[model samples]
Target chain A: MIYKSLLPIIITLLITMAMLNYLISHVGNEEVKALEVENEYLLTINVFKQLNNTVPKIFQAKACLLISNPINYTCNVIASNITGIIMNALGIISNESSGVVRYEVVDYVIYGINNETIYYVTIKALTPMGDTTGIVGYTYPFNLCYYSQFIKELMNTLNANFTIDVENITVVQSSLGNEIINRVKSLIGTSSINITINIYYVGVFRMINRSINRTTYLGQVSYTARISPNNVHTCNEITTLAGAFYVTAVVNRYVNNTYYFSINGAININSMVINDKTR
Target chain B: MVVVDSLVFPDLVITMILIIIILLLIVYVTNQLIELSMIDYKASMGTYLFLKCQLGNFTIHLNHVIITNGTSSSNYLLICPQLVVNGSQIGAKVYTAYVKW
Candidate 1:
């Protein structure tokens, strides 16, 4: 009688144990899966935030140009138009990617009043994934079409009588700073206009291990110019040019654990001409 | 005596199996949590470069600027028109020297 009673109790215990084990294992697997999903989501959110922060610096720097009154438009008017274009582009990009995509201008070209040669500019953005301790980063390139196209759009909006044709747009990576000089040299080969580029790199830091650790990069590019229209005959014709321009930028990257920065001030001598001369 | 021994042995074996299962579950959960946390932190910080240019009294804004090292040649980095006066651009004609790492 005692044996029979004990046997049922023991069998019941075995069944209960088996059930608990299975339940625990299943719950564990689910938890692991959930953690993986959460990680990916966090990484995506972080990268988006970083990109958002970096893009604005470019806009702010460019916005300064609005201070100069163009022939037909005031600084405020030009600024409003550029701001509208940027906002529209941002809105479209945000909507298309469900807010996952981020970008900034890596390069751009601008045309002079008469729409002769074009000026090129470049911008870059970064995307990061993973967590703070360890992360994966990616760099995206942004190219603003050619100068002619940019000028055409500016003219159309202002109803100005300027037309231009975009020739080509290209971005070449330089392993050394000299690479940029060489490229510029080729473009201005044997031209009388003296070109100068000011490059500056700013370091970014993260609070790590009770101290600030360098986290990313930022940079700026500026130029100073002196030009004489007739290089051969006008030894005394050297004149200071107006509408000199400079650019300063901040760089940060979460994706590659690398950051480079620079602030540049540029002045173009050709942009300035005495009110009396029409070349 | 024999009957009692048989009952105790099975009970002990079951308890051991249950403990092992619980430990494994805990290990798996912990590992996943750590990995997820790291990834999230990295995503939060991204890379970016901010560029601004100053000219005489006027400044031309360039929202972003990118730099890439292209060749192995040596060159001087120059920032011309060091100063801007009135509406005109002037060249200070000074160049800053830099070398690649």
Candidate 2:
């Protein structure tokens, strides 16, 4: 009589368990797709946040170079190299999406009386659907003032103490020019391997009566600085020509074989006259 | 005959109705428990995916608990045991912590 009375309770318990299992399985199946969507959204947000934290730091460090010498070719080098290292680090951080998405350089815009070059640059990591995760923009300003100062120093050194003779000029070009270039490189902080500094003078010198013409000046003396850590061997030359009697100096700089910066220095070169007649 | 019909029949009918009510209550409670588990599983999985991406290499442990009125509570470990081999987690730097909730 007891067994018969408990039979209904036992049967009911078994049926309830079966129904619970079915319900759990059904819920699990329905949520799989929703879970996947949520997971992707969360991952994207995580990546974007990480990028926001890091990209600015890298940009700030590299952009600081521009503050010192805006037209320093090493600025470009350091920016790209550091950015590449950071990108590689980020790739290893998360294996979800690895590699550079896209980067754009807004051709160096020469602006202001100082002739500062402004690079409006932007880098982004995005998919084809325009879903951007990581992005950075920088309006990098570089003034040619630093380079102009060096040129002024070079001109002063050449005119003040050095005699206008082949031997003297050769010594001045090799020794004094090398010293200046080395100092500039050190000041710009591009202490990388495989740097080549080429300095030479260009123009016509009518050596009449062992005296330089009154209208004579170093037509175009160039400082071709090639500083490459990655062996790209790009030549950046700042060619400056002093005007008649040093009334003015016109400066033109070619970076990566493209003329980008120009400036005019207000200085008197009247003292550079070499009159062998006086000797 | 009058006493048998009034008292015994009424008792039998009441007992059947009580049994039906108990079964329905059981089904309702079971459904609610399963729904809670479903929510827990979804949240845990989402957390696991997020940590995996943000933290690089990490481990996750999710402990699920279920209790019923007449039975003892049961504990379940949702994720399987993942062995850390050769002290190398995909050759990545151990960023923060190994395992999280």
Candidate 3:
């Protein structure tokens, strides 16, 4: 009968439907895998965007201090501080730092190269695939030479060059100005707290070796500059580059898809190298 | 012979043709499904490529905005810290982004 013929057709239809379902499922799985890889890139870029400039350089400052002089803050202390920062930023990174990209922070390594430090952080995603990295930045090579030495040498030069005391310090004579000093000047706002020293490497050549190899005569290294107590915005009585600490505030605001990151930091007085015998 | 041709044989022929059509439809639909998947893959990849370009710009802008000052760019700004005696430091400062970061 006709019913007997319809049975064969029904069986064929069921088999075809099964095959199509399997094909769709397989293709979907492949697409999902590809999507995961894209997500990794998104997550990396997001983390990089979040870290910005000031954050890395601050850690580098600590690294510069630690490698240059270990007595001020223990490695453990700095490590804990780094952990605290990552933890504090967890909510921010998950919710706010990344607009749409998502990831987790696992750990960070304070890597030093060419007497400079950059942060290499491991960011984890909730994907089947694992962790990845985004970099932070560096302090200047000149700063690795130490702020005390820089200020002291400049002070000596200033003393020898002109008859101006700390009070009358203004407009470094264009003759006295060099590439390095001007480079330092532009990083900080006028009458700002914290000193930011940024040095872009020509070749991050992975070629590095650190030594305390510095030689300069520092006369009267000890000088005092006032620091405002309540949330140091300005170094009111700071002249002659003394007592000013490294404190950078990141006004990183994303408005209308325009990202803004600016740093206002201090030139850490604790890393002072006064005596010729010490440095 | 005429009865067989008119009823069972003709019916068998039509049924076979319908089965063939259904099988062809399945093949066409499967190919379309695959093509759709590929389009989605291409779109996602394109988005990531755009993001990668933005990252490059971000790197450039970060280097310029931090050390140097006073200039603008709608494209790649050179990255190097220097002291320019002539006028403004010889580099781009303001990076006018082409895409949302």
Candidate 4:
């Protein structure tokens, strides 16, 4: 009688264990799904990090080239090179089946090229969601702007160390020229590959537009200085009547945190002639 | 009548109580064993998954250790990590682990 009574309890225990096992496996399946989603996100994030790290290095190299040898590289050539490197990095990083990357140069600015050797450019890149084209099925939408931030920082650092006292202008053109030349000497003092300065008494005007606005300053000062890094020998000469404008503007529209700047200006170099000895 | 009342009925009641207690004990032990087995299963699966995936800065171990760089955590359960070996997909089982980056 005791054995007969125990049979039902044993059968129930077996059933309960079986059910619990099934429940545990079901839970595992759900957990696995969550894990897969997390992994996918991580994968994409890694690719983006790789791309971000690469961009600045390329820009820095290009900037160094531009600063060192200003005459050889125009802003156009530098911009094209930057664009190519960005696209190449994107291709290398996200070469997966459902990955695509594309970028465009929305705006750029070039200034003081023929006169003082300054170039500013910015490019905006877009990685849209879904495959707009069959070639690269878009994984996600990522908007990245590669600005001239690296170059800008370099210039800002250079400027801060040396201040130009523009508030006091001498009445005599010759005396005023002497004061300006001394200002350049104080700023350039024994450091830099080469130094060139063009001081302008140009009128300044601001033009506001929907996308980008630029300030145009038109004036002319004929000035050139040849300084030695040794600080042993320094000479600068100044002349007058050069028509040039310093154009500072935001020439590009910003989209999705990406900014485009178009930099355009014109100066008549013939009107302001620096003595070839100052070269 | 006195024997029935004092001895026989009392014996039957005691025996019934003993049987119920024994059944409860058995169920409790079975449940505990199941839980232990489940924990072991989870650990092994977690190890397998972690090793196979080769994710950055993630590891799985049964114990704890101090790390300097990134982040790490202990996982109790994991799907088997998938890997390609000899150009074929393979799944593996590993140990329960604490992962650190």
What shift in Å separates residue A261 of candidate 3 from its native position after superposition? Answer: 54
Q: Using DockQ as the measure, what is the rank order of every candidate, best first?
A: 2, 4, 3, 1
Instruction: Identify the runs in model 2 with alpha carbons over 4 angstroms from their true place.
Output: A1-4, A29-38, A74-79, A95-279, B1-101
Report per-candidate DockQ.
0.01, 0.07, 0.02, 0.03
Error of 1 at A21 (Å): 1.7
lDDT of candidate model 3 versus the reference? 0.37
User: For residues B40-85, what per-residue lDDT tens digits would candidate 1 score against the true structure?
Assistant: 3322211101111121121222332222221122231211112111
Q: Between prediction 2 and prediction 3, which has the larger DockQ?
A: 2
Cα error, candidate 1, residue A144 (Å): 9.4
Model 4 accuracy (lDDT, Cα):
0.36
Which ten contiguous residues of candidate 4 chain B have the minimum total lDDT? B83-92
Candidate 4 residues A1-279, lDDT tens each?
444575566667767666766766776565555544433333333333333444444544554444433334544566566555544444433333123233333444333322232333333333432112111111101000111222233233223222122211122233334444454444333332232333443222233333333222222232222211111121122212233323232323322222222222222221112333234
Worst ten-residue run, lDDT, model 3 chain A? A200-209
**lDDT by residue for model 3 over A32-141, one digit each (tens)?**
56655554544455445544543554454444444333334444455456545554454343443222334566666643343333445565544235655555433333
User: For this target, which candidate reaches the highest DockQ against the unseen true structure?
Assistant: 2
What is the Å distance of residue A212 in model 3 from its true position? 53
Q: Candidate 4 DockQ category?
A: incorrect
Q: Rank the candidates by TM-score, best first.
A: 2, 3, 4, 1
